[model samples]
Target chain A: MIHRLIYPCEQAAKLSSRAMEQALTMPERVRLRLHLMMCERCTNFSRQIEFLRRASRKIPEVLENDAD
Target chain B: MAKYLGARFARCHETGITTRSISTMAEDDDLAQSLETHRKYLQRYAQFHLRDPSLAEDAVQDTLVAALSQRDRFQGRSQLRTWLTGILKHKVIDLMRSRDRALPPDAFSLDQDNNSAEGAFDAGGNWVDPPADWGKPDAALEASQFWRVYQECCQRMSRRDALVYSMREVMGLSSEEICKKIEITTTNLHVILFRARQSLRTCISKNWFGTQHD
Candidate 1:
């Protein structure tokens, strides 16, 4: 039933980024979960976003000691 | 001021600490050398965030001068670049705050075009075009080529968008702080961030990861 109530991918993507910055409402969270369950592409997109966020945090660390 | 720099150099000698009896003049030379070495990186770092070459140059030049005069305060534990960046961060914030005053009343034109995450879904809120698997992405982060392509993508974005993105992602500033620095509303910053991420994703996928990034 949850999967059947699929939220749109655009909404899912928006919620996905918002989730990084702050808490998502329960309904928002549930709908996004349902959408992700039904969509591999959204899941992939979400993971890619998380990866970028994490990588960004590491940039200074990478550049700090560079002899250049 | 030149007078202040002169005072700092004079004080360098007054320390009279036996351990550092080595000429303060020598330490001064080292600071000058290191500051010059890091100039390009510092300039690029500022330019990358400010998206204005002249302002970036101004911030970097000030940062170098400040670092030079305050050389005595630098503890040896951290890398010099890291220390310089710490100082540069403050300088950039100061420059941006002042620069905001000169901005036109309509500086941050809300780019409504990107507000809609277009083609991301259908009217019913379901995926019309879904994202593709990026495979294992960890390996790509270590690839120098990936960084080159990522920098190109950033450089290609509009000035304001690039500034907002760099402030958030590269500088790791909080969204609220970024809003205050750039003087934009939170919603506008989010839209800009989303657009930046979308463009970066497209660029990365097409150039580095796979095709169809566009």
Candidate 2:
């Protein structure tokens, strides 16, 4: 029997959506955690999402404070 | 005594955090100070969302006027900032929609080739090069400079594209809700977001990253 990936591509995309909000449903959360345990690519993608979030936050603060 | 305690607890639960109570409490505070605080944040939030300093100032003033007029309706369930931001968002949408109507047919040609949409990293998942250190003694200065460039690039985008990107990436709105608010299909939303990001990325590279020849 083929061992199906815990989170398939479409489901992984949904997981990414939840991950963007840093909120995941119980079952989806479990599946994402399980997948991340075995998948390096997904793990890297998660890190990228987090980096993007942090980087974006700086833009508004900077614009607001600019003297020029 | 136990019965009296239970009754008190039930009453406390029953009367929990009503909008009327919060509004009354808010009204009892320093109105001027509260309005000033709202103005400061609203100015910043509007600047970020609208990317036009003059427009942002106008939006902040408008938000204050509206909020003051609607003070009686403020239940205080949400933070004042959130409430003010909601007002500014609506104002921005109105502004953009009106501006869209005034544009000529060819004013917004969507044919520009956006080359930066692909991953900034290579196969090894490393940035083409680590971001350059500006060699500024003050980290804050470096950060501020980069942010100015970022803001400028974001402002260059069309209003619809910028709105989609800001709502999705910066504000963290879900795609479905963004689609509903922006009145576009999911595919169109994705394309807009992709193009917006690509434009921003290219702009940042050109302005901040310096050229390969440099």
Candidate 3:
């Protein structure tokens, strides 16, 4: 299999979410960064994932003491 | 199958029941009151995960009844809300597991087709049109009505995609745990999650950010 520096937006998006599941290999890491460096869309997509994760963590916390 | 089959619920409201022991009625009252107070949160949490409002309402109702029935086991928990969420997670998963895999004929097709996020770049993997900066998006998240729209967006997505998003984002389940719990592999989890986020971001960008300041 041939490895490249940059991945397509689709692959980059998948890798971004995969990174949340487990650690990425060195090549996968490099390709993701290289792709993001050239693709503003994936960079924004990565940030959106980060934001969603953070926001979602607080959903259950919001009404924790409301009932008592 | 109605839980309210007890005469306690059927008793005339104008004149309270004078039949059985008062202690049983008191305990039932306390449990019912607690569950009722937390109903909205339970319903919202279920809706977020299940993506079907009617199914969500049923799950919430079931969860409330289950919690009340098992109140002896849950007596004096530090955070009742968290406990309720735990019950809700199981209900959502059980409902999903029991149903036929609702994968739409072509909506949830494999990532190889990659129809959603494709065509945004050239052959060399450069962005054809860059995404706009959504600076300090927390302001929108903190909005009073943001979650309503958020759930709306999740509901708009395909069932499987929304479930993955809900399990990961709303229920805070790890992707590995989700893969082990369900039939989906880790690779499919990635693609589904990517699609979910893409769809949510686009929806929010159009609906929330477009109409708000900053």
lDDT of 1 at A45: 81
> Share of real contacts kept by model 1?
0.63
Question: For model 3, what is the C-alpha lDDT against the true structure?
Answer: 0.72
Separate DockQ for every predicted complex: 0.59, 0.10, 0.45
Residue pairs in steric clash, candidate 2? none
Candidate 1 deviant stretches above 4 angstroms? A1-5, A61-68, B1-30, B50-55, B69-78, B93-107, B111-114, B118-129, B211-214
Clashing pairs in 3: none
Q: What fraction of the true interface does each of the listed models get right, in terms of native contacts kept?
A: 0.63, 0.11, 0.56
Best-matching candidate per TM-score:
3
Question: On residues A1-68, what C-alpha lDDT tens digit does candidate 3 reach at each position?
Answer: 32556556767877887787789999899889888887777888789878878877776755343243
TM-score values for chain B across all models? 0.71, 0.62, 0.74
Candidate 1: which pairs clash? A8-B125, A8-B126
Per-residue lDDT of B46-157 in model 2, one digit per residue for the tens?
A: 7777767887777776676677557667788787767777777777666665667688856544443332234444554343433333333223334656566767888887
Put down candidate 1 lDDT per residue, B27-136, tens digits, no spaces: 77677777777887887778656768998988987888788867778878798988899889878877876776678857756757546554455666565545678888
